[model samples]
Target: MAKKFEKIGENLEVKNIVIHQLLKDAGNRLVNPKAADNLLTIGEKEKTFLGNLDKSYHKKSSPIYGIFAEENPKFRDCLIDYINGDCQFYDFSINVMNHYKIVLENTVAATGGYMIICEYRNIITSNDLLLILMINNKEGFVIDEKSLTLDNIKNLDLSKVDVACLINLTEWVNIENNLPSERKTYLSFVKGMKEVSYYFMSFIDVDNKNTSTESTKRLITAIEAYADIEQWDRNTKINKKNKVFTYCHDCIDNKKEILLSTISSILNPDNPEHFQDFATEEAYRVSEIISGDKVRMKFLKTITYSDKEFKIEFDTKLILDNTIVLDGSGNKLTIKNISPILRDKIKELSNKNA
Candidate 1:
């Protein structure tokens, strides 16, 4: 009955800000500036906290804490592996991400159209081809990047991207500086992205402003639309008789009337309460496609644990917030152990599963 929206909780706020600042700051020195000053102010005794020394950042008496920053994502062949490790995901003790300064400009040069930025967990290159193969045609994957070009990548199937990503450039860049933000003549044109996945757009250095951040906030209406739900308050509707109002006079008569529309049987009463439920259902469908029950269970349970922790420690919206719903049956199953194959099976369902 409520017009649901995703809320970014407090726990993720600091890290989210830090990551953005890190990207924004790029390779600039963390000395004498406000970002540095803020850190130094809070960490008078922790000069090495924000500094780039990987080895000495976290000494026993050091105040510089970066939970899970030390994780070797290469070990996360699947999302299930990360989830299986439990609270270890939040232990940001180090920044193990590789910078793209080596080939940053070249990669960007290769891009000629609107594209999303994909932050790979571990595997970047070969995985892109393998993912394309699975999503479109198994034969589309060309592991040999020797002859690969942006044009070739454009021609390949991109429906199956398996990573954490942020989208950008929704128009062709053959002519930059001017673009129709809402519409494009191209067939691949899509507007207002509502989800995240993994894919490498290019390698960018730590000091590059072009580098994309990981966390992206999605709205409830936008999410429902992606799930193909029938009724979500996305468009601002107006009545001819009283056109300035977003809702008709009937809604003015009853405060709850407008709110009820989101869940109204007139729209789709049978629809699940949360947007993540739509995602979870998609995961189930993917699990069916992948035919891996153990993997599915592990993915769901791992997310459940993470969600629980987020809710307890930060009161932030879990990725599964009202958007995700576990049925009575799903709620009952608990996984104690999971295998890599099972994890991949989960990845086949959703990014969190992998």
Candidate 2:
């Protein structure tokens, strides 16, 4: 499992910010990034866009644990140059915008949006972070600062964030200092629309570090830990656990990766991100997207308790149906209703003995 860090956009002190427009002409397959002369002043609109950016990032991101790919290190190179003062923030933003355009060009049927690039430091941890948000041009309008008129620019609807990435510069720098087991990936990103977001991941240049099994294991552990802290009764715990298991099984059957945010919502709909926050704070480090492991996750459907004298196994569904009951205080278990097959089997054995 990977070590978790503070979410990217929390407690931000915006040091620099820039926005570039990416638009598509009718009938053109690719979009282009418009030229920008200066950084935007950190104002109310920007603050409003940024206020919940971190929360959205937390809810939407998938972790990438490895460093930049050696063969194509354009993003890493640009980032290093900017960090080393070889390039200004404006120039870096332009470079990223250009790269995104290149990626979009190669991607068939790829579209474009407003790209907001920001460099900020966490007020609490003082960690330097970079955030890139891509908002579709049609959803909202960006106000023109000069004339206070709506123009070609667009302000992101934080609620509708589709594609974005948050890079932890401090984590990247100190990645080598941490032990192998302690190293968490520096990049967290989300591909908003399933079909349209692959290029966005490629634009960021990161490799996934954890395997499906590891991610599944950590997720299960996180859920169990959270339930323990909540002090849920056996039936409630089993019911919720079964719900998670069913969702995961369905995803696995469809060969899809499980979404942490979805699981969080399943655990607590009123507080959608509560389980996610617990996983992070408790250092379970569950990625927002993880592949389900069929072999390891199979146990979640049914629970087993065994001893030298006998073995007991039952489906978690039975607990919720009131067919099975657990007495935690007395360390006793009761089965209210036995299946007809089991009852007949017991009756046959009794007649044979008699």
Candidate 3:
């Protein structure tokens, strides 16, 4: 959100003047007819020129540049829009700016001050470039890459660089301070969780069958806790509960295999295949229930409460309507009902127990 630069000094300053000359020389190499016609692509040429520029001028630091070619159609279009003045500079800079910012942040943090020069080159159709300079002093500049021709380079003034287009990175200095404290904390936490999850998923994929049952149990517990907290947060009457429901429903549907396998051993102590069959059947039954179809069911034991015997009924409409409920404490409750035919089984069990 911060601008790229924070300050502007007098035009024709020594560093600016020297850098302008260096840029001109680099531009000349970039536009060389022979070099352009070489087997190496434009991107490679641009990269090579930038590499040389770093070696010749900024021996202590190297500039970074990214080339978006015809293969990268989206970025190529964005670059065209930027050159035609249809898009803002930031729009064209999105792909590379974050990486540059990260590099600058680390460099500045380590050495207390740093300067990074980078470029974005678009050669999908024709060669186009944008120059970016970032400094720790809260000042930076953007230059028209096309303006750096052999003839005009001699008269170019860097100090008078578009001060308005300058990037302000003061917010990036302490990246933690750039956003609302709570939001920043939440984002950092979520990012860390995603990184951990990525590694864990990779590990699980490698040894899914032999993965520790305890680890699977812990993962299930964590997932349940997250779901519980998220549901509670969205339980407010004004909250968009449907969005949360749809998100969770989609997640379950997408990850059904992983979820089923995770608890397969526990669900079927003796026969995992049986558990898998039951899971598949139940999934189909759930779909039918959701579609308002009266699905056939088997008898299960009835539940007795307070000395009163009650046979559970799997009335499709009732099951679907009362599938999810918010309790007094705002906890989400899922109700599973037994089929009407379970009454006879319950009576038989009670008589046998008596």
Candidate 4:
């Protein structure tokens, strides 16, 4: 099977990494304090943590989307200065941590987590990138290295990423140097499931213009057009539609975004780029990455009919799975494998009528 993101972790280079602990103050409810010193060491645990984060950042289906926010460019300017050798990595990281704290304090409720500022290169493209990740630490017991005794320790939680952002330094510089491709977005970040991570966006000063609903609608139209152009049989068309619908529904349920490339691969794995090229040529306006809109996605997952007296709904997969068969001649549905409760209810109704 092909990987979800084929280019992730390819020719990746980790230049510098630093993590600072953010803790909520007990005395002061609003103020959150940072640890005395940052962890500059990149051990095996850090390596695994960074690897997972890199994959999430590059995954086209991820909720991460590109943005261009020039109104408030403080963070972007700082990055540019660092890239120009105006400051050392450690100093630049401290500024990033401090700025994050300011955003948290001024805006919504402050969150406590380990703020990781990493400078890496060549993950998705040959671009020197800086990724910032915020993750809560797990409370666990560990043997102390000095005393050789079990002590309470806080370990970085590798399972969940609370918030993250990737800054494409090379792309930004190229844009500044009067590059040709002006539509490029150098900043991309994860849109977390909750509002607590909204501060991360404020810290970076970027805005996402593309919405998930519009993208989904465009995607559906493009797929239908592509299927028609290829002259697929009715059965083949239905199967492909169901397959893509299931993929989109899963992404929405999992709080992940839909990737056009992933959908293309699913539609035509032998020629993965075939669908993408068709979409481009047809001018569908489907975004490369789309945040899954749960409300909009409901239309794709189920078939439903409703009236004053009767309302019936069933999963789209039920038809193909042979559980619910449709007869065109009779213009009715044949529902098989009825549940015991439903069967009993129908029997009771029949006995009462008799």
What are the per-residue Cα lDDT tens digits for candidate 1 across 190-232?
1111121111222211111111111011122323343344343
State TM-scores per candidate.
0.18, 0.55, 0.17, 0.54
Give a tens-digit lDDT track for model 2, residues 80-199. 899889999999988888888887777666677667787887766657889887766453456443332234422333445556777878878887467332224576655454222556
- Rank candidates by lDDT, best first: 2, 4, 3, 1
The collision pairs in model 4 are: none
Q: How far does residue 268 in candidate 1 sit from its true spot (Å)?
A: 23
Q: Where does candidate 4 stray beyond 4 Å?
A: 1-10, 25-29, 35-39, 43-45, 140-158, 176-183, 191-196, 209-354
Residue 292 in model 3: lDDT: 8
Regions more than 4 Å wrong, model 2: 1-10, 25-28, 59-66, 142-157, 176-183, 191-196, 209-300, 303-354
What root-mean-square deviation over C-alphas does model 2 reach?
A: 13.2
* Winning candidate number (TM-score): 2
What does candidate 3's lDDT look like per residue over 1-354, in tens digits?
533422221111111110121111111222111011111122432343333332222221111111122332443354447557786544445433333233324332221112122333222212222323321222322222233211222222322221101111222122324652211111000111011122212211212211122222333233234334435442331132233233334433332112343233333346645433443352221110010000111011112234366443232323334653447787654564645676679888999999
What Cα-based lDDT does every candidate model obtain?
0.22, 0.68, 0.27, 0.64
Candidate 1 has its poorest 10 consecutive residues by lDDT at 125-134
In Å, residue 261's CA in model 3 sits off its true spot by 30
Clash counts for all predictions: 33, 0, 7, 0
For candidate 2, what is the lDDT?
0.68
What are the per-residue Cα lDDT tens digits for candidate 4 across 2-31? 325443243467778776656653234464
Which prediction has more favorable TM-score, 2 or 3? 2
* Model 4 weakest lDDT span, ten residues long: 141-150
